[model samples]
Target: MKYTNPVVKGFYPDPSVCSANGKYYMVCSSFQYFPGVPLFESPDLVNWTQIGYVLTRENQVMLDKINSSGGVFAPTIRYNGGRFYMVTTNDTTRQNFYVYTDDIYGEWSDPVYVDQGGIDPSLFFEDGKTYFMSNGLDDEGRSGVIQCEINIETGEKLSKSICIWQGSGGRYLESPHMYKINGSYYLMAAEGGTEYGHMITYARADSVWGEFVGYAGNPVLTNRNKAPYLIQGIGHGDLIRDKNGDWHILCLGFRQIHMWMPYHNLGREVFLIPVKFSADGWFTAGRDGTAEYEYEIKGDFEQKEKKLYTFKNTSWKIDWCHLRRPDFDNYEFYDDSIVLHGSGITLDDADSPAFIALRQRDFEFELSVRLSVDGGEAGVTCYMCEDEHYDIALRKSPEGTEAVLKLNIGGIKHIENTVELSSDSAVLIVRGDNFRYNFYAASQGSEIYLGSGNTKYLTSEVSGGFTGVMLGLYSIGRNSASFSDFSCNYK
Candidate 1:
């Protein structure tokens, strides 16, 4: 059957997967935003459901005022002996840690800090012993794909950290995973800085220790050289075999709005690439080892359609996200309405704001929300980070309530357009396409088109962050606001 690329969309990067009881569980890198790592479950290699995140407790993951792209990095999820383990790096504190859970539907345990200093840490369990791997410095002060035997229960190092492979000689040698295949240890990693030149390389050794030989056809997988391709930045993959013993790789890649433009605001997403292993005990991924828009898989998995979640029937916990540490005490969620209290902190500050957002899963969509504010301002926004966002806000001006279009680029604020509202309430509409997002306001039986902002200015290449655009409802100042009948949809 034909399946699409980017099995998971929108800012879910550093793809990692592990199987348990014939079910596949996956995780992706979530930087700075609260609820660190977004989690998913798949019956086959395709259709995935957002179950929950690995780091949800305040003590498990740290994200207190850390700037965008400063929190959790690459996360690796592995299941063994009826227990699930997730290891990752808290880039904000430069700390490496792991958390475990016995129940797939429950909260994870407190972090077990590893002594290693690195990013993109992964766990490999072998014959009652656990191994920890990451792309960082080793005991010899050598930096590469480092490994060490670790006591999983105590986070204690049972062996010296060893530098297994230095990559295929590319910049940013990160996101390493180790696997034992046919009595040989194989190490796979990503390089090329995760941009246009990103790729995946591998090496194998007889033992799990040093002197590993690089694969002759090194970059076993990459789309760096593929032109006119909709998807690029293909690398940082994890291998998993399904119930039928068919091998598959879950990797990270991005989609540009246009073939001519390299910029992408949807952020790095998860892509599924099928793996083929020969009798020679070697594996190749994707067709011709490059990513594409669609793929043929070995399973009879049917595609899961995305449901349109109108606010009247939205799943608040599963979809909405809050910035920094959540001030949940100041908000309430209901079936038909959301009551949010504004803080003195503006959206311009990295501090906590009264905001809850949904990941922008589609490049083109329509979002409309009816908002009523008592004193200050309340509306919607296309939020990238604190410094880069486009707002269509309804603020209480000296001349009564007014609709305003404010654009914040690189910490510089610009008020592009404003119009007085005949009433204190209005319906704010944000229509987004590949190029720009246009705003509209409707009140007192009439509608007015606000302004539009370029999408390129809010992308990672220009905004300097690890996140994509998040469409959210927010309130600033001490006004208590009520928002209802919110609807965001794509056909």
Candidate 2:
């Protein structure tokens, strides 16, 4: 089937998918945030439901002050011999760990340290023998691949490691997955870094251990362009076959505006493309060197209505993740909305701001918040980075119900307007373009302006983090507030 851009959205990076029990299960790298390794299940690959998280207990891994992209790297999920396995690299210790489960949704086993040095570890088993592979920087300052045999029972390495691919281009290589087909072992890997230079490549070996030959078409897929491109940094992929025996490629893609560095907050979006193998055994992505249509899977196709979020739920949908570990004590769920307690810091504070935001993917989207604030300062806002933020806030002023629109663009604050609310409840509407922010309020009619200040500083280029912009409700000062009717729509 032809899948669209961003089959899954919002910061779900380094996706690894496996099929089991007539269903497709996916796990992605959840750096820093606890309850790590999001697990998703789908009857059809197109529509997915978040079932549970893999790391729920303290024994899973020791995570302390893990920064963005600092906790868990790429994770590979595979079901083998009546058990499911998840292998990942922890940057904190630069070591590999493995977790298994009889049931994917049930409690997962505690992480057994593999002592493997490198990022992106994948496991493959054949005929009762298990093999482990990983990729990372080598001794010579180049990215290289390593492999070893692992004892399934004890989760220990049984053989000395061997280096496989030295990588091509100036960029480093990572995220390697090994497969055996037609009596030849193939090692597929992502190279050219994770940014615009990303590319997927493969090599073949007569033996599982060495003498691997690079594919003639070194980079099976890449987005090397001097101008605009459909999908930027298209690599870090996994290949899977459907029940019908057709090959499909699932990889990550990034979308960016002309001047703005593509903020990959939609994270590494899941995209499915068709693949073909030549008689000599090399493979290529896309049918005719082009992306397939959205909704076209290479099997008996079925259409189902996409699920929408409802006001009633214990937590937001699985697609939502926080910039940092969420402080549950500061928020609570009421009838149909979320009540947020104000923090001591303001929105401009670097370390402490009570904001919950998501990625801004599409050019046109609408975010609505039903808010009532008392005491210090609080409201809803769209945050790109520390310096670049736009907020519609309600703070306690000498005048009653002071509602203000403020934008911190490049460390400068521009107050667009301030009005006194007749009642406690008010609505804030934020509309975004490809590269600009448009602000409006329900209390005022027809007066939407290009956020009335310099916003060049809000770009990700200035903010140092492996994240994109997030949009959510936030509170500041000592007072508290409640936000309801929180809804978002994309066009």
TM-score of each prediction: 0.98, 0.86
- How would you encode candidate 2's per-residue C-alpha lDDT over 407-444 as one tens digit per residue? 77766878878877666657777776555656666654
* lDDT of predicted model 2: 0.70
**Model 2: CA > 4 A from native:** 57-64, 137-143, 152-155, 258-267, 287-295, 302-310, 313-319, 345-361, 385-388, 408-418, 444-465
Q: Write the per-residue lDDT of candidate 1 for residues 1-491, one digit (tens) a residue.
A: 78887888888889899988778899888887777788888888788988888888889988988888888999999998999999999999999999999998889999999999889999988889999988889999999988999999999999999888899999999999888877888888999988889998888888878578887886888989998777889999998887877888889999998888878998888898888888877788888888877888776667776747687655677667788897887798898899889989778888778998888887888999898898878789899989999999888988889999999999999999999998989999998889899999999879899999999888988997678888989998998999998888875
Model 1 RMSD, rounded to 1 decimal: 1.2
Residue 102, candidate 1: how far off, in angstroms?
0.5
Please give the RMSD to the true structure for each candidate, in Å.
1.2, 3.5
